[model samples]
Target: MFTLPFSALALSLCASAASALNSKRHASLAQRIKSEQPALRSPVWHGLGRDTNFQITDNCTGSTFFDCFDYFTDADPTHGDVVFVNESDAWSLGLVSTTPTQSFLRVDNSTSLPSGQGRNSVRLGTKKTYDGALFVLDVEHMPFGCATWPAFWTVSQTQPWPLGGEIDIVEGVNLNPLNQMTLHTGPGCAPNTSASDYTGQQLGTTCPSSDGANAGCGFLDRSNTSYGAGLNAAGGGVFAMHWDGGGVSIWHWTHDEQPCDLADLSGSPDPSGWGTPAAAWVANGCSPYTYLTDHQAIIETTLCGDWANSNYAAAGCPGTCSDAVMDPSNFNDAYWQINYFSVFVES
Candidate 1:
């Protein structure tokens, strides 16, 4: 989850602490598993389960745009220096707009605020919640810039924090060239041997959000064109996330590279024909029902939050995150031009 409301450095330190404790407590089990499985496996995605036919349940596009989501006006959970305005303010400030072909959610790139004031932005979340379903995000452009943290994610709607779970499908900070997919949940959930059976590079195998270390299981998509400036230049395409009893799979494709099935979203979606996904977290043993449920999808752009602030210097961006926010031009490209957000369920 991108917005766990904790500092990234703190999370890393907490994870290290948890790891140390786990190492002492589960040494034997860890050793056994290490011996049983190879440290590295093939990068190819193995079809663990066949895809099911899907029918569109809710499609947010065109005239029904504003009706599909609610503008979140609360303070940012990630502590970003952003002010999330309500629907009226969003429209009045030009932070949100919609057309028959596209909908826009953007940071206030034209107004330079006071030195300490947060930038005006919009965070929109779906009104409907989902348990196990297929989510398709068709975008034309995504937010990106120094100190900008943009994410398209889902968190449990009914449970408290990590108890339910959070899934970050499209997330990245600063000028990162690749997309990150992560899961933040409680204990008793970890990846199996087949966890590496995806195109993306696996960052972690554990999926717990305890000890203040929301460093859940994560994968990094290898494609440079999967996010940031490259994604905008290539003309954004489809990002599909399949979540069910079997597991979770994420796929990303540039507009020119998208599969034929996605070309016409009106037809039923079959993941089996979509080829290997960009990332996959197979259940093998991890129970989706127990760890993840009743999630509401979200799209937001924040500034100098937990992740972005911690990695500010490392990303080689100029000045402080605060400094970047004061410059209106810094966020000119920090916007999401979305074509549609559609949820599909098994037929």
Candidate 2:
């Protein structure tokens, strides 16, 4: 695994800390909106198509979490210090549950194990595969504690990895306040971030795994409320990714900043009116239709993975990721509170 120098990592951490302070200010604004506009609050959309232009394929809620996702109990492919548990084990350990409208997915928060690999957790993948579509996620809380690496991403099931492409919509490690969206693909695939109207800072232009650091093509959202603690403070938010024949675009709207159409969910989402995306990847050298296909949605929280381990000390955590992750007290806040997940296809 490749790593950045301590000096660079320190700079990144400082920047994230500044973002956290700003997010606190936005959280207060969101709270005022909630108090003043009670009528704007609406439950997550759980039914099918509301308009003729889009068809809903998956309407995942707290009640449907287990039914819609397949338990991925296998070993961590990213070499994280985690043991993924089966469906029965997860529920028996109180690591997964559902209330009326929200779903809770959590890590093992009761046991203090030895400082070897780490404690057990849950990883879930959607059973349905998609070619091209719009994915919208309404989340109330996300895993944000130290040593936690939470991600909401989509990957193709092709062998050798990155052949079909991987789109990371929401991903961050350690105590990162800002979200990092990335694209990993086989050779010859690169994104023209400069040509697109995205608000994030593009770390790299090429997405080929052959890049020495395997950094891929990454864009870092500067908003502190885009991930982790800042996100939860803002009452969570909506993440929408539209992938089609042309390219892929991702947009984020905090609870107080959601568009009227998204807030109401009365009809199909209109991305044309959503303005500039946080990150937009236009296929400059590769064909998006041919390179990105047969992908399934995945939501997981792993501990001490490659990225998290690389920046553990820089993030000012207590100790090494493996050691801290085994302590049950450290992960008290490590959990996913999802309101709903919906996929819309063009009609």
Candidate 3:
């Protein structure tokens, strides 16, 4: 568990105070998780129930592009969880795409349990709305190798880019050697003040890679741990982000970390400084945050190209190849061994 500086801690509580509605949303979110979904786990995954409450069935409902819109549209499907995972259809939605073949989102985890392509991302808009809840991301496997980029993030269902803040709960780049948590804000914001806080873990630092509006974006590689440089191997850990109504906080706890706080969901963000769009930023199909405080719903697993494919294979093809992606034999596919995806509420 990572500890937040006194300043961050204070700001977190403030954020929670503002978005009290989120508390109720959390309740509704938990109820949505019905027992089973025939379309969820597919046979190719060869999954075995790791826990009682959770079951990885071998049944994927394809991409949410065609079906996902149904959730909020006219032709709603008859299903259980109303899954919106990225799949073949997702590649066409401009929401999910893989290079070379556009089949980027993997179909396999540790137990040979396949993933459902792009994470289950929902659009947050004026018509479709919610209060507050935990966005549970099923710990699916990630492309394990040197030059592989994967991400599990959220977009504002309303605005285009920075108009809504971009909360990157999970993201790793080509051989980044670390998981970088970033926020892409547009204009109407300070320059140097774009990126603030500890991008890295204990005894670590956040090194901003780009300039311009995306300056706030950076990676958190915890090499100082006794585990050595990095190891996103067979068993991947939980990469979480606590979005306090005000400010936002992120952490990477692979069953490790010193001052880590998984219980704190209170994040405080500058409403006025949520970020506008800057011409210098690259946010194509990349949606930003819009009053991201009011939480609701539980989002699950998915593999996305825009955020995951560090090699940008969807664009054309990445030069670097990994055993996991290019040749599975050469590389070991890191399984985000998922036990139970649950959201706790304040009794």
Candidate 4:
């Protein structure tokens, strides 16, 4: 038998303890990997020919929302009778609030007054601009009322509207229950409806700015649950927009029907795996890369805007747009409750 000195024995014990700790740590890591195996197996690219995977680059919620977006205090460029409030004003006026789990952007629903400029609301735009990427919004409620015109869209920060392009993911006016997705580009770019894969009805073939207001190629989702009151009754849902060199596409999924892939926040999103989109605009005579660029996400609720006002008669709402918008009680449901809004970039 070999006898070791006291110091040598102590050193051996210390080495054994360290080895045990390391082994335990490795085993814990292995267990985590095993638990996440199912999610890891999901494809990152759905055969889009892009070698990169989509990873969440921004998760805008709660405090993160304020950090990512800037409040627009300027008048509505769409000729909406709206008074866009700043961050401080929004909170003070109860137009905006954030909890640990959710965020709220709402219009004034407690006061009764004439709709002159419009109701008090908040309009938020992302501070950072994006060229092409994936945008996903998990909403619990969206603004919808007799005189409300709410929109979740994107536009190029560049000067000259439409020339920089605009993409309206969720937009409607008055009592419209369905969403209308549209794309407005500079010129030459148009919806190749024949080549696009979607369930929406194409309203136009041209996307030039010269086509006039609401002139961009449009696609209407006939599903009532895709927007407005129906959407809220169904407990809200997820709206996803995928933009790349191929073109831009939009998808909607009811809260309960959302794909399992989207439930895993840590996993990469694969748009290719998503079935036929609700609306898609494939490049035709024009190049998407040139038409859509430097766009920033925007969320706003305007009262009796150009769209809502012009279509008021058809909406069958009592009185004029201004009259309907002035009643605070009527706009109690005119608010947006967002669970989360995320942006993903190619990896």
Candidate 5:
């Protein structure tokens, strides 16, 4: 054995101890960070852009929800950074009604829009600049009332209408949270049953249920508050949707709450957890066509008619487009607030 002076041995031991301590400190930091906001391990899709503009709701152009000929945000779209307002509650912003034969937006701007837009019309720019695993949008609150439909949604830039795929982040009727995650394609839409929707990952692919299915396929998910309440962009929560080519899923996260992960949705997406696709979406026309590969922008505010028009009482609901759904009596006068619209890619 090599003998060493007492002073030398003490110095060597001290150096080793210091090194070990530093390693432990570093490990601790890594753990803390992991717990706070874990990194996206299998992040297939990612957010291409993000903005936290406090003044996003500073433009106007569309018509009100009260017998207006045009929308308020028509002339001034507020660009990519601007949040289009209803302006004067006169232009319906082109939003038509879908049910009960009425079209409206209840002119109200508590968040930012001095001007109100309603039913299927209102723009905050588009997700056109981004393309990846998927796109997620979080908005303030959706307008609610009979025939009142608000949505935080997306549309394909390359393809139009059903071909491109319509992702309705928030869609409901009456004053309920029957928030729905639907994929509209071809002639068939709204699969009506959990089994019809073929979305396996989010719906439970562990084993097909007794119904001989891969979980609800189409418009999976239906709920009032428990699930819907937590997902309404109106109340301010993370009503996020996932899309990465062959997969699609919707998640509802409450304020300051972590979102339910794939494991949580292991079972058949709760009864209301993006429950199942609608009945019409299961037919051959709709199945195997829910992947949105080319949407221009992500709709982050409340939209009426275009998707939430209820049952189509407005002139534009069934067909005619020129009969503007603008009316000044109704307005949401609300501004959609965002913490951060971020995107993460799968590495």
Candidate 6:
């Protein structure tokens, strides 16, 4: 989710087949937050050679996963009904844990809290920041339920947001069956849609983080199993974000379809062999080097923020967004089981 200053954009711009479907499923909130903003694969180089190889720089995995990330204990910038807990609290509350095989991130699903008190959850960002790289995430399960919002993304930690840019690799609210890929950048930057090639369907053309209340350009994945319940049912998958001089692209592969090169963190990854990406932002209009840089990978699950609150009824979920948070049983499946996250850069 983007955490930039909000300015209202046309509700029509937010219109999409998915939203239309949501409209049919759930009723809209009284007032919507318009700022909700919401990739890929091949190694074939535009200016660089096809021989370009990406080597793993940071392989965050296993029991040490906790040490690789910093707990974000601050207030939810999206104003979700969540209290971002510190590492200590996160451990005690069972919000985060690491094992030899994977890491687990979960929100408090047992405690029925009073009104206005956000539930306990964990938000984490990698300690290392990168200007440009290939990010590969191996996921086994992700949070899902009414009023739940989960995302895996990258945003700059060194510069003010939109200045450094934001790239959402996997994001969705409620029981969204597909993933939404998006890019957020400052003014003067818009994706070259004509030149960009991808498999996912584009929702909006411009990438301005402000013009559309930070709606930023968004694209919805075509795979039914790319997100939420469908993703979990398919036994999870791999999400890759490739950001470099050419531009940024994202790809999603189900558990069985993941490329062999990506299976081994020790080997170099070749995107050229990965096929068409789900979403791509060509450098013709937006330069990745200029707009997207020095970013840390982020992972978290928030409840009933601007996007979820407004789209609550559309998902066919009962009650207001805040009310949904009070029911502990509503979040029985609210959790993330991650295999590993590997950052690769051109060698």
Best model per TM-score: 6
- When sorted by TM-score, best at the front, the candidate numbers are 6, 1, 4, 2, 5, 3
Consecutive 10-residue window with the lowest summed lDDT within model 3: 271-280
lDDT of 6 by residue, 240-283 (tens): 99998888889998766766566544456778767778888888
Instruction: Compute each candidate's TM-score over C-alphas.
Output: 0.84, 0.83, 0.41, 0.84, 0.44, 0.86
Candidate 4: give the clashing pairs: none
Against the unseen true structure, what C-alpha lDDT does each candidate score? 0.81, 0.78, 0.33, 0.79, 0.36, 0.81
Q: Write the per-residue lDDT of candidate 4 for residues 1-347, one digit (tens) a residue.
A: 11111123334554565587566666667785665343322122234742458877788876556678999999888777678999898989989988876789998998788647477889999998999999998888999979899999999998478888899999999999899999998867755555337778887777886524556888898788999999999888789998877778898877666654564456677777566787887754556778988999999898887789899989889999888767888889999998788899888
Which TM-score value belongs to model 6? 0.86
State the displacement of the C-alpha of residue 278, model 2, in Å, after optimal TM-score superposition.
0.4
lDDT of candidate 3 over 268-336, digit per residue (tens): 211121112111111122221333423222222222233434444533434533223333232234322
- Give one digit per residue, the lDDT tens place, for model 5 in 274-313: 3322212222223333434465444333333333333334
After TM-score superposition, what is the CA distance of residue 336 in candidate 2 from its true location, in Å? Answer: 0.6
